[model samples]
Target: MARQTSDCPFCAIAGGADAHRVWEDEQVVAFLDTRPLFPGHTLVVPREHVPTLTELPADRLGGFLAAVQRLAGAMEHGFGAAGSLVAVNNRVSQSVPHLHAHVVPRNPKDGLRGFFWPRTRYRDEEHAAETARTLRRALGGSS
Candidate 1:
């Protein structure tokens, strides 16, 4: 993200302009995604307000992904998301150049049929919990 953070929507969200905050720090913020594919959909953005992944400082990249991992895991276990897809677009689908990640929750029986990227439900709550636990430990959440 080359553009200045003030011109970015993520900056506004980071500034606490009325957002459903899930997690936040000085450099990153996580909140609910309004137009969600499933419940507990969230977006994690850098507070520095870079427009794309390439612009993020080297040290900050992992932190952002860590947030995504933690949130995705939590959604899987708590919300029974079943499955999830995390995507970061550059100029291709980068509607907001502020380097935001879309953590979309997926369900197997949701009637969402697509051969492109098939998603299956978690085997059971235990399966989901185990996955979340692993992610939490790896991503620097509450291990």
Candidate 2:
């Protein structure tokens, strides 16, 4: 087990100083959002105190994502959400020093907007899909 050295909420939770427990494993822990952006939104945090993905040991990354995948399936069925977004804010926008993923459930008419950007245009969906597939395969399995 690692010890906390910061006041980050994730660090506190990992250190057993908070009380919003929901999921936990050797390398990762997930808990319901206290200030949820949507219903059933949860945060999946790495147990180790690494600040970001680039700082994490390769071995720990799998456990972190495995936890997120578990929550993704459960969120869709449990909350009736159409899709889910596993978002992470790094660098300039990072609120907490510790890296965490926001597993947000998205449903049609959920009053949420798409993650698309204003300056973006869909020139080709097929190419995009193919590229995504290649990336998924490279990342282990098709996600």
Candidate 3:
């Protein structure tokens, strides 16, 4: 397992600090992003503190991606979104040192015009939890 750093926010969230977690398993966790591109923007990350995709152990890679895939599907079903924008930043633009895949819900001409990320915030915790609940239901359970 990769060592957790005291300063990594993602690591803290993985360790069960106050985060709007939507899904979790022995190997991974999915949570709502604080500054979301949309209502259901989520981030999937390894429970272990791996810094980049290249560093993810081969055995864990499949499971991590599976979780990401599940989140993508949930985004579509839960939000009634046309699709999702999935991405990963290895190191460059990686706000958190721990590796994470972004799953942003998308729709036709939602005003995301280009590569520029115009972030938005949830109305409140209730708003975030409602979004999480929808995603959890789409995933078949709330964990």
Best by lDDT: 3
Score candidate 2 by lDDT. Answer: 0.67
Candidate 3 regions with alpha-carbon error over 4 angstroms = none
Per residue, candidate 2 scores C-alpha lDDT tens digits across 1-143 of: 77555767787888776544556777887765555666456788887788887887887888888888877776666555688888887765667888888887777776666664122222355433443343233224433
Per-residue lDDT tens digits of candidate 3, residues 41-80? Answer: 9999998999999999999999999999999988888889
- The 10-residue segment with the lowest total lDDT in model 3: 1-10
Q: Write out the backbone clash pairs for model 1.
A: 1-50, 1-51, 1-52, 1-55, 51-97
For candidate 1, write residues 34-131 as lDDT tens digits: 54444455688988768788988899888888888777777676666787878888878567777888786677777655534433455555544454
- Work out the TM-score per prediction: 0.72, 0.74, 0.95
Q: List the residue pairs that clash in candidate 3.
A: none
User: How much is the lDDT of residue 140 in candidate 1?
Assistant: 55
Q: Residue 102 deviation, candidate 1, in Å?
A: 0.6
